[model samples]
Target: MSDLVTLGQRIRHFRTAAGLTLDQLGDRVGVAGSQLSLMENGRREPRVTLLTSIATELGVTLAELLDTTPPTPRAALEIELERAQRSPHYTGLGLPVVRAGRSMPDDVLESLVGLHRALLERERQAIATPEEARRANTAQRLHMRTLDNYLPDIEELAQQVVRESGHTSGALTHREVGLMAQKLGFELVYVNDLPHSARSVTDLDNGRIYLPPASIPGGHGLRSMALQAIAHRLLGHEVPTSYAEFLRQRLEINYFAAACLMPREQSVAFLSQAKADRNIAVEDFRDAFGVTHEAAALRFTNLATSHLDLTVHFLRVGNDGAVYKAYENDGLRLPVDVTGSTEGQLVCRKWSSRAAFARTNRTTEYYQYTDTPEGTFWESTQIGTSASDEFSITVGVPFADSKWFRGRDTANRHRSTCPDPSCCKRPDGDLAGRWRGKVWTSAKLHAHILSPLPSGTFPGVDDLELYRFLETHAADTEG
Candidate 1:
């Protein structure tokens, strides 16, 4: 129903519930009873002031009065069918005409409703737009940040899994992970034909974990992926029902996998020793754990605040200068859009994240000391190549904490006044003054940043496929 009609009905309902007649409500809100009756009949639209006054008199919020929920699927189809039957185009088709006030068989109407519902569902699936996907991701990210990118329950579960694996201290190896999988009654199957986008898939009914042959060659990536699959089973995480839940489950699994690779106690000890050293670097930690730089950085954030009593920032910047992922507990201001989203926002050129892209060596680390309006932050960054693209990952600490980090004394210092054009660091002021009203730089659109995570309600799988798999496994167990 239209919002106006919904609001009118709500007003009438609330008026009656309040034990007040139209005349009484109109008197309370200083309006005529006839005007209130017109509004209650939806024959007249109420002005904002009148609506607010009426809502106050009825003891209801404006939103509550104006709330209009979409009809249920069956109701929606019935409404559509009703509208169609009245349409000249539909009546002109010469099919069995459904005239107004004419009764039809219950089964026939139900069958038609079912058919229309299926078609509507398919249309909805096919018409899933990019904007909808962006909204989903934005919501997920907001939730993740709201939880401070940490979950204590997941951490406790990770600790339990680590204890069950019989390895509580030191870096976990692939051999041990394989044995753990076997101990859990799951067979590891390596195949060359799995899709590149798919890292691993677990078949619970068959008790098998499938991995691409490329992921099995003695790297931490294989072990991490395997452990993630194992975590899903061990933690009893069911298929997520929504995008937010999906992202949360994936993050939990990732945390579990990282904890498996670098057990908490051992990592804390290593970080303690590393912190004692005068030159702290993320690469050093990566080498210590035999994992990727990005993985090490992520692990660092997990422990930095809780264990090390340090506030830090982490950034993963794509070659195209869009931020892929960012997390910070420090008072640093990362770039964000008007909606307060950090991902897909362009980094300042003077910042280490964007400046690292200009370096020739993709392997060596680049360090920069930048001064922002917030404060000075010293960041160390390194470029790495993934299967799809090359990106730079950075870990930064506040200037007060920079003394414990390597490259703190580096001469690569740059003052960045970003998100502001008139900052003193910008050299374009004189040029803009010389060529008044002549210079323009078009903003570059990075479409890849807008791409959704994947089709699944989870991060990596299709939700329907995941649900079907779970159902099949449940049936097999019951049989």
Candidate 2:
């Protein structure tokens, strides 16, 4: 009785011996006849991609529906501690949500919970209509104002990890510069503000891109401020070019769900078959991508744009869930600021040399970005060091790309090693009483030099419309 209830009675004995009909076997596999009669009746479990499209429309193969009748060699330290506590690296929902009702091994958890309740009842029957979700959010805000269709590739993997770590001289994080910008392909989001019901709106009416943890602190900055307060309650008050094409199709559905959960050439051949004294971790990419240590740190920072010498930076979330979007190289109009750093604090320093400490030691770094030699990793908690407790976050890289040269390189490297030493040289009433840390720890860096002024010409939104009207009047007088 349990070879997953005998593979749901051999998929109802090969769909009634091929005569077919759970609506003709869910219309030859696209799925739905009550989720193929709840996966032929073991009552659901089918998403190893719809059990390979219902075992290629029932001909059969996925190892002949889990190769039947072979159990019994148990206890190798309780089956590797139940395969490392039902690994997805230690549970971000995988092994069919870790074989639900445990004592582990109910016919491989009823054949991975009947292919995860037959692909969530065929994705609740392919949802969509509210006029196809407002015409796919008005054709994704006119394709993000034709922002050259798309290719910062996460600012060329953060300017190829500061030109292959040639060095910017100290202070780093933003999850170790977003795992060297996802080894180098690109995808990252970290928001913390922008929805106290947005004021003059118009990235084509904020289609969607948010970050709001009481507008920015944690449950990961309140899921990027509740995805910009649900794209400012589906664009009502203004800002509409279709709100950057509803955040470029929700950043292309988080870059096609991190390329179908880590498949950029099988996550660069499984992080190049480990061993360079190991470091990839986020729990070894959440047990090879089943996902969630924040979705394996957003699929290892989108494996840094598949490696144009690697780069990715979401130092934190953005587009009004408390803003953050930084990159460096070939889009050089740089900007950085997200300076409060509370929730699960971590503010290590060093973005280049002290031999870039082999790309950040003991890992964990994600400063999204708001300038720094030390003065803007969330205004360097007035540079009190030991990173002002309360789960702090503030790190930096990119030694060049404007702020008159990060305010004259923080006044000529005031005792260099400057990721922030009390705002790099402290003053202005000790950075206005540790500036009570809330610009929701800002971010922005993707800068590699195509025009801050080689005369190819740049500056738009009408030459930064008075610094976007003093950053939209300091995000509407701090919401």
Candidate 3:
């Protein structure tokens, strides 16, 4: 019921309970009997002054007569639907505003409610800042780690794709991937002008994949990118319907791509061989598979525990010490923020990931032995460039498994008192006393940090473009 109707009912109940007829109550509140009778019958709405006067004459506070109790679920739903129809975000979708007193079918009402809820959720997600995105990424990484950083379903699909392509039993080359793409009916187009934020774009309608011209000459990066695009098509991943689905599908496609680049059987065999030889080098794995060091590190996590019986940790740390990505199944506890997030946390300078930044030679890999409260670990780090940052990718294993690695005996050792102070690494009373109040870093703001996610049916596409594409495709499908 509307607030006005509820108020009228309350007035009638209270006036009858107080043993007053409509005229008696009207005389006390300076309203005519007929005017008050109309309100009681819900034909007329009462103004606030009359409401207050009636509440006083009825010997109750205005709030008491207003019936401030929480609404029933059905009433709450109706109120939400009303509020949603009036919201700019909802109206901006070109949906009609549902006014009071309109009779809606039950199914239609439920559908609108669901759509309103979804749009509200999308708006909430869209307004997330970079820090929030970082936290979300950290949560997703934790989830991936919880799944042992492996997806057997996606891997199985990838293996099927490889077998069907007749390219079995080894790492795939760029030319081989191209042939596979052709077999799957996709054309690769190298374009000079692609969006800076996008490395590749697939036009499903045209059966074409666009890539930057620089990525055309058959390198590890190009091969990986091409394989990822191909994997998306081959695996039958639909365009994502939501942000969460987008993240999941992206991870699935990435896993499929990695599987394509490093087939499970071959990758397992290589890791087994490396484990037997007691010399696990990421570079050797990268060279064997023609993939980047980062890829090799991530791939190792996929196979380490399940295949090699060794738990490991991997980290991608920027030059300024912010963690870009991190995963650990090992017992070693990584540094985390207040929210238990490892990503975007400042790495302790004593840790290998951060110390690798000090190496003068960016080309050479840096190795370190670190003793933490959790345990001792051996870490190998190499410098790499991402889209807009220079970062160090490090893979570390427990001390028990360190003997199998070549960097096990690195003289670079540090005691890390991370997530804690008063340890040997942090000078007890010396620096604290000397520079107690002397230093403070100024905060810098970047506008892009608060920019909303791209607007469209898909996260990054333009909405109008997506609508047009859908329309054209719909007509084609109908024809």
lDDT of each: 0.74, 0.37, 0.76
- Top candidate by lDDT: 3
Model 1 regions lying over 4 Å from their true place: 1-148, 168-170, 214-218, 422-445, 453-479
Q: Flag regions of model 2 displaced more than 4 Å.
A: 1-395, 400-412, 416-479
* Residue 180 in candidate 2, Cα distance off native in Å: 33
Whose TM-score is greatest here? 3
| Full ranking by TM-score | 3, 1, 2
Residue-level lDDT tens digits of model 1 in 1-479: 24554456678778888999888998899989999887765568999998898888889888777766422333333445654444443456667855212265556666766664564444334332445444555676666555555667767777776777677555677667887789789977776644445678777667778776744554788888889999888878875534545555677789888877877778888888878886678898888878889999998888888887778899999887788888887878888876666778778878888788888776778999989989999999999877777888999989999988888888888887778855533568677699888778897666665555454334545656555544654465478
Tens digit of per-residue lDDT, candidate 3, span 39-117: 8645698898999999989899989888844234444455567656766666777866674332766667777788888
Query: How well does candidate 2 match the true structure, expressed as C-alpha RMSD?
Result: 21.7
Q: After superposition, how far is residue 380 of candidate 1 from its true place, in Å?
A: 1.1
After best superposition, candidate 2 residue 55: deviation in angstroms?
A: 15
lDDT minimum window of 10 residues, candidate 2: 450-459
- For candidate 1, list the clashing residue pairs, or say none: 456-461
